[model samples]
Target chain A: MLLLGKNTQKSVLIAGLAACLLAAPAQAEEIWVSNEKDDTISVIDVATMEVIRTLPTGERPRGIVFSHDYSVLYICASDSDTVQVMDPVSGEILHDLPSGEDPEQFVLHPDNRHLYIANEDDAITTVVDVVTRTVVAQIDVGIEPEGMAVSPDGKYVITTSETTNMAHWIDTQTQELVANTLVDSRPRHAEFTKNGTQLWVSAEIGGTLSVFDVETKAKEVTLEFAVKGVHPDRVQPVGFEFTEDEKTAFVALGPANHVAVVNADTYEVEEYILVGRRVWHMAFNADKSLLFTTNGVSGDVTVIDVASRKAIKTIKVGRFPWGAALRP
Target chain B: MFLRTVLALCLSASAATADVSVVIHYLRQDIEQPPVLSNLDPIPEDLGLRGAELALKENTTTGRFLGQTYTMEVTHVPPGGDLPAAARSALALTDLIVLDAPAEALLAVADLPEAANALIFNASAPDDSLRGADCRANLLHSLPSNAMRTDALAQFLVQRRWDDLALIAGTHPDDIAFADALHGSLTKFGLRLRSEKTWAFDADMRRTASQEVPLFTQDLRDHDILLIADEIHDFGRYIAYNTWDPRPVAGSEGLVPVTWSHVVEQWGAAQLQSRFDKLADRPMRSRDYAAWAAVRSIGEAVTRTGSGDTAALRTFLLGPDFELAGFKGRPMSYRNWNGQLRQPIPLVTDRALVAQAPLEGFLHQTSELDTLGQDRPESACTAF
Candidate 1:
């Protein structure tokens, strides 16, 4: 069930403000990047394209996400095996949640209170409730679960295990696996479509993306990317995001060092925009006018202009940056 | 989790028979080594065997869900023991054999008539001949060959534009073989060997390392990097700072190209380290990883093909569809031509991963991993 809370109201207000400020471009949002090696978060002001602040985090922070209302942030400090809740405004850590071992990536359900975390070492998906800071359920999953995602309808959550090569689907209401869908070797990330009809899973080592019919849990398509002058082994597809209208998708090809613009309707690659080395994940600005990619090898974020399809600026961050999220 | 998986299997088995049964035989013969000069710990006694054990545990965990039973029988031959006879008996029981033996012993067992339907994994020997003229159809190599290690170093050197190199090789047989392998890569990468020397001193290195090393390398030609080829973990540790020209030492010493290292903490490897450490109580080594991969390959083949038939498993392993999550950032697959597992070689120092090869811009027509070792065109074996 979707919450009729300030999160929804704030999104509407942010969208309206984005539209009005499109011409002048004075207001600012922040692209927060999690540095896996340095244990820091580099906050980049959208207006200036510069790193505004570098805040300390728990050891080896990898995955990061903002609350829907843009009030707080969740950082997965992987090595510490705990999730830190931080006030984005004050840059103060509120407290830590009981995340299982090696929490690499996670998803915030539409309800905004439940977080599904992927515990890589334990092979368990730990669902935590934010209000009580208590673990809701610890569901046993496949080996080496790395990526976590929730459906738009908030009915199911998916965990992509790197070793098991399967996407384990858990029914949110029951907190148990309803389906286990096989993907290619080493599935790294998964996401549902905006309409919640399709589930997209990226297999990092397989160098392909698997799309499934969400209702039937059957694979609909397998998408492969081939960047010119790049070897097939290096063309690893990881994190992905869609355009505002859901017509086009921008996928981060890990180690291939490029982002592929794809036609969502046809499932065809349109163009490859070169980025930094070993790009892991991405986050779009509030207006969808800018895409920021965290390059793990280069330790920087490559900001791409969404309309022009060109890299506008490179903002240096801490070492081995893994994930990016927008707070608008 | 294992208990849960087993419980689920018990519930499923009540309705159906356990269909898939896989039995593996693991063999090893640790050869004598020169006393290591450095103070670091020696290799673990269960180097290759513990890896096979870990893989067995993993296989059973996955097999529990798929209604399969997996087991591995281990036999470690004493040094200078009759390895071939022991291997013959081990091969008679099962077709899947994981071996950690010398090249001669592996070749001897591979040539056995009783091993006609068997698949053997070369998990210890880094010999190049096994990947070349003496290659066997039934044999698969999980360990990186000597050529792969040297080629990885060559790629890192080329990426750094370190063209001219000087070589200091120990007198051990493995050291000579590693140096021989490096010579081929230096020629292939168009790098110059400005000076080459073999260690001939008989003094105790701990007492006279600083005094003897500098004078030994003083007359050498100018070079950009110093290459040490001491595979026995013997004399190379003393050659780093004692080199006359202050060149960076690499190869088997300061900076190394390895199949697996404790320093590899990226790309889901940290979890693997934690898992292995939990099971073995120590960091995983190269041989352990190779042996683990060998056992897991069989497990993957049987799980995917849904049968214990040797031909089917072999076909699946050598096919293009085979992909193993090796925790090396790249999905590894066996080379169909020579049965060598294709993987990324990590170039590391003592405490950090410096880089992984093939480095940027080292492109290949097929796979970037193919550039590290013997490609199809250069491979001498007609066996697959």
Candidate 2:
């Protein structure tokens, strides 16, 4: 280390301050959301409930998923028929992956090696190898296959058929049909219980949540709520997330414009938070302390305190927000 | 004996051919009866029938080419009356039927065998489900879909940068659907709802009236707009002047989204409005515009095909270039994909219709009119 003059010391001090600012721990995890109508992704700092950055994506991006280790994010451009891979840190498009016709939603495998794309118009789920960005397999489901999810064990994949009112289970290993369960009309999103024993299917038209036993493929319970027609005939429960302890699950009721907070153990609705009109999808912070829901109709993302189940603040996002994911 | 036999054959043929007539059967309750019609201030009854008259006139003008004439046999069925039998009897002689009935009555008519060949034009009942899940192949809607109207208002609000909305809805069957359409539009165009308040329909009219008396107050300052969905035309009017906060009202009443307006003079609307006023002796309203579109669509079908055959007319009406030079900007035609008519609706303020969209700037990647209602991307009607 050489001794420096006053000007040099000033420059060093400035560099040190810049380093400190860069090194300081980020206070909150960011939830990345793709707005279908606006063609932009809103990066929301979970702690402050503020939009830190809005990353532009391809036309009409609907589905979104974070890469393993949360380095990259993939969004399904329904209009563009391509999966947009973006670096979440820089909010830049890293690469584009070809997908099936009219991709609406995506589900990532536990190993993070494969991605399942729900091709809405084609009514098929196309499995794409993440690293290769190649379509590996395509399995037919039903008319307008919308929401998709991967099982905890990464052994199975499930998709909701909007018009067919059914949930399809596919064996991820063989890329074959596992089971077909007839659900309520316009079944939208499917979410597995934290323990991975049960699955909850939200029916947009039927306005009821169907709980099915995954292993035995048996119908368990249909969770009914007080609000009728609050969600359009399309209960369109688009996005769902569970608390860290797996004690609670929050379901975003699409056209119903409300969030159903379900107690995981009791399987009862702990509370219904009226967030905004046409609430589509939701995301949870890394710590699972807060839940963020995108209200498509209201063009705002509502932040809910997980413990209190109360809406803390609503940050205005782009038009018609469909999907959201968190940056670890 | 041969002459007598030929005479008998001629008589039998004459008996088989009934007089060509089109029956207009509607539910008595659904139709604004004399009392309700009398109560309609600021809107005229003949204005309500302007579309019907224009359609009939167009038919009469072009009927000479087809060697057949058209006539409207207006029949009002009392509430809960048997409409199917009445419609069947009418369908035997009538080539077309225009219905302004409730959803149940429309469904009942649709279920009839005679209604198969006879085209049914729904003038009211803007419920979107009738176009979506409960869509009837035989039925074609002339009235703008609920989504269309809501989208009109939403587009207008969006262009004005009125992003925040406070929605107030009345407790009515149509009101709920209207609200849903409004909500759909708001979401589609990226508008935020600040607060939503529900008012009871059966609640004291006086109280409700006073509740909306101060319509625009400071409390409403947070909202850029107030959307009121009162199809009953009761509460929404009050909301205009009496909101506890001050905000412009949009929806059923104040700033209404309609297919045609008396104030709409642009794009040959003035000529149509004048023609309608001359023919119907009343100022044009939305219902009149829809009714006119229904008649005009049928007339255009007949004119283009130059045949009274229902199948030929239906095919022509469903085809592109079957345009109606109605009051709306540009000629209107059905989407063919869903039988939804694509027309520009007027977003009217109290003084005058403020904006119209598919406005000049708002262009659809497809047909510009496609931007007016549900885009093809999210449309549930897959069967074109």
Candidate 3:
């Protein structure tokens, strides 16, 4: 049955991490943004905050993530129906993995050997063996699976289905759906706390952020946005981030042009930091000192200082910048 | 490691499957004569049913991955047929029903005790009363009501500063209903009805009397636009360029407010149009879009909840947790007060789309789409 109890899979991940001690400290230290319309990935130097090189790739490059050791980068080239692997240093194509169909987003396993990819159109979550570059398992999920998050403990992998309006919880060990927790409409992203106690999902059209208890999978609270001059319809909650300390969060309010800083424990929306138009996904730099947001319509990335919660810079990017990820 | 992987594969393979059955019940009102139109083709035999079938296949594409499969059973009843009996038979089979019938027949089917536990989608009937005083707890409408369509046009006219309207209505039941809706919109938007007239001509315009059609529309008072209410397609299309005062014609003629149109090419609508065109071998109509939306609503619910239980689905659908992407550049959801779907109405000409209503200035507390129809404050429906 679905909604099974949480399995004890953390020990397995901890043991795996113990073996890869050398790869932990030598971080990649780079920022990559996928320009959806450009079908290319732009790498930025973490120290300089400047574009190093633009690597051409598949049809629609929406999601990008670096492998745990930072030797390889996996790009979910959605329109091409494959996830392309590339060497970060030389920017050379390593291989292409059959990632179901329309791979919009993916989460690399903590074990550093398997990758969980969300196929947007086909409603399937394919788990691929990174070493073999072959699909290990394909789990059925809801329609338009866009956002994926692996728990800190690595026991559960949750994929937020946009059309289905639910965050499907998949047991990592069994590769079967354990629970379908209904959220608001058009959930674009999901992020778990560093401690893995709570999961936050952004519902873009529903104009709310839902917080859920990780173990029980019960909705704890729903937060709504109210910008002073903006209409409620424009206050679409999209991608969000939870600080490493799990005390604060920054949620990108698309079309509203604001990022809401929320109190993680109290679930209080503290302030709305203004940003660019149609602000989408966000990423934190190496030290969590700077937060970068890809503004789709405005074609720029707004950089926010984490300490002051103020936007400091707006860097121009390619057309329709969608998602961003940082390696350190 | 190999043993654990093998065991995991076995466990996932034995996972439970979620199967949902959706039944479409339509009352085919038999008529002795169909409309005689020279320019446009006659209405198809399988108008709404074909759309539901296409959506079933679309749903199955995604459903197969979730271990969910959708099956549609269509029951067609003849004129003066036992619609209630047919609805009862279908209700016994599935709790998810799509009704492609008239207002009265839909109400009869909804009033059944067995349908209390069902989640019904109204695919065809566009009567305002269905979303107003006669709304049911089980019935969810995908089709936009007459009030919504008229309000959409009125909003556009107000935005364009076309304050004066010359209203002409035919002597048909549906025409009268549309006329009433137009009058309501005029009052809602503070527009002036410069002149109102009724046409009683029954002569065939395809024959020698075609010249008289234009002559009949002449001599109207000062008006910026001519709004025709001819649901029977008798004179709406003919009055476009033949209007007496050289005014633009709308409301079922030159520039119409519709639920869906083949001309809509924005917000990924081309993908749906192309997919539907490949399936139906013709351009998709408003009725087809309505039916497709109805089935997709159910498919969305089942995919989210992972259960076909009617009570859970109904609760989730009526609650804030429901919204379906209808290829309108926005997410469409149901209004809790009345089960009408709150969506943007596209104003389209024959060749290209003009604009979507609930236009920029139209404001609402909850959603802008509420401005296009009977909002929660003005809704008289409390059935649910």
Candidate 4:
């Protein structure tokens, strides 16, 4: 309660500056999306719901992800067949990492240095070390690999092949496909639970979500979605996110124009929230109170209120906006 | 037997360790394609078979993990050759046959005693009779029928609010079939046809199209769309950009209904197109996609039942349990009433995809896709 002296105030100021240095990235909080068709990334301010910056990227920029520390961003650059590392602060591309052929999707390993990328055309999962900028391994998985996910413990990496209809499990230590688990046809995205106890995969063509036990690698549950007035074929389950408590799930049903609110524990759909057309992927905000969905067909992002399960705003983005990443 | 086996597969749920081998017998007839008016893109020598090859490659991708193996044995019949004899021999090896031939030739093989147990996929013919009165229990159609194609066109046109319609039907049998189908679709969709002309000219369309097309279409009351029913690819190409009234030409020429096209780059179709281009060294056509779908249908069955026994496979195929990832932005399935693959028909030109049918508002009792082709009520087949 007492007033501080001038000497004490100067020392406190120095300590505060040191903490700010350690924290870094004190800029505006934003959500970045890779526009596939436009070959650009749209950076939208989370607070203002407006595009703050647009950075040119390689051909067909998709599957965007921020580094663990939110320092750099990695873009798939699918048509260019390379992974582009970019400085998020300056919007300058740092370098190109060899990403085999048609790297459509990828997951950065927990090591934060290695990226396991799905080379779709080559039917192999390419592991590239970001620090070294070299290919660590190219493990053969299945044909037309699209979805990539890494376990929380970094012990297992999963690659879901679109045509093969199997999720190829790669051992991070051996960099080999230790097991292959068959799922519904045309599996597109793979996601692991927060605790890494379960793995959920979305099948775009199959119109189903398959959940597997992480330990035994056994399929524990299968969730199917059917929204009224939406064609079953159009109800393609693509990308999904779990709520903060991991009790609820929001699944993006591509072309169905709806995001399904599901009870994660019961594996039942609670409600359907109508969003933009052909919703591809989504990213939650820092507080987990708001979710941003990338609508590929409509060329917009639907910001949803998590608690109410309602779309609060529509943020127009570049053409065919694909992947979403939050910079917090 | 199929139901029990599929149930076992469902119960096992984990490991499918049994090596299920499937051999698809591809029987193609080498008939002289009707002369086309365009020389820009020539038909590939290996058109339909290339699609089957690619599908086999794709099936093997899933088969490798599911303990299944798929191989294709193709036999090409020379023009005016004994197709039934060739089909009989192919059927001796395997009951799963994919036939790429004209409607009559397909019927000749389907009616054979050996084919009674065989499951044949018609990958080339667009004849509606094959899906209707002439339907066979063993023979299923992967290719869209003439009615399906025309209905897709009709849906596209109606959804775009194009009301006035005129038809230029060729005199060939295939053309007549297509014209009839289009006429039926026009009526089904409640769009009145303003005019109908039969193109019976024996002169070279290449030389006379510019000179004769205007006069040929001169007498017609100008309509919104001139649907050219040149299913054989003759004269239809000449109609576009040469119409007397400058009307848009559809049907076989401009924005045609096709099973697959290089122009379709949506819904992950670009990846498929790139793969096909790499394999065949040319753009994939409708026939190629038909064959691919046919082969993939068999693969789906084998994966589901985990066995290659044709009878069990057929039972599973005709049953409601089968769904195919058709790359058509839909989970395609066979119609039990007529054995036609229910899929979204892509209406496209050689350049770009105009739209996919079952457009937006076309509704049906069961499925919106059912509004495109001959629905369950309209199906006249008693095959099942």
Best by TM-score: 4
Q: What is the lDDT of residue A310 in candidate 1?
A: 93
Sorted by TM-score, highest first, which candidate order results? 4, 1, 3, 2
TM-score of decoy 4: 0.94
Give all TM-scores, in the order shown. 0.90, 0.48, 0.77, 0.94
Give per-residue CA lDDT, model 1, range A163-211, as digits (tens): 7777887888878776666678888888777477888899998899998
Regions more than 4 Å wrong, model 1: A1-28, B1-19, B36-39, B60-65, B203-209
TM-score of chain A for the candidates in order shown: 0.93, 0.88, 0.90, 0.93
- Give the Cα lDDT of each candidate: 0.85, 0.70, 0.79, 0.85
lDDT of 4 by residue, B269-327 (tens): 88888889999888888899999999989987887778898888888887877888777
Compute the lDDT of residue B356 as modeled in candidate 3: 92
- Candidate 1, residues B1-384, lDDT tens digits: the string is 211221222222111233798999998886776776666867788998888898887777566556678988989889999988998899778999999988999989989998888999999999988998999999999999999989999998888899999999989889999999999999999999999998866754445665788988998899999999988877788888887778889999999999999999887788888889999999999999999999989987876777899988999999988988898888899999999999889999989999998787777887788998899999998987
Q: Is candidate 2 or candidate 4 better by lDDT?
A: 4
For residue B73, give model 2's deviation from the true position in Å: 32
Clashes of 2: 23
Q: What is the lDDT of residue B339 in candidate 4?
A: 89
Give the Cα error of residue A72 in candidate 3, in Å: 4.6
Model 2 chain B weakest lDDT span, ten residues long: B1-10
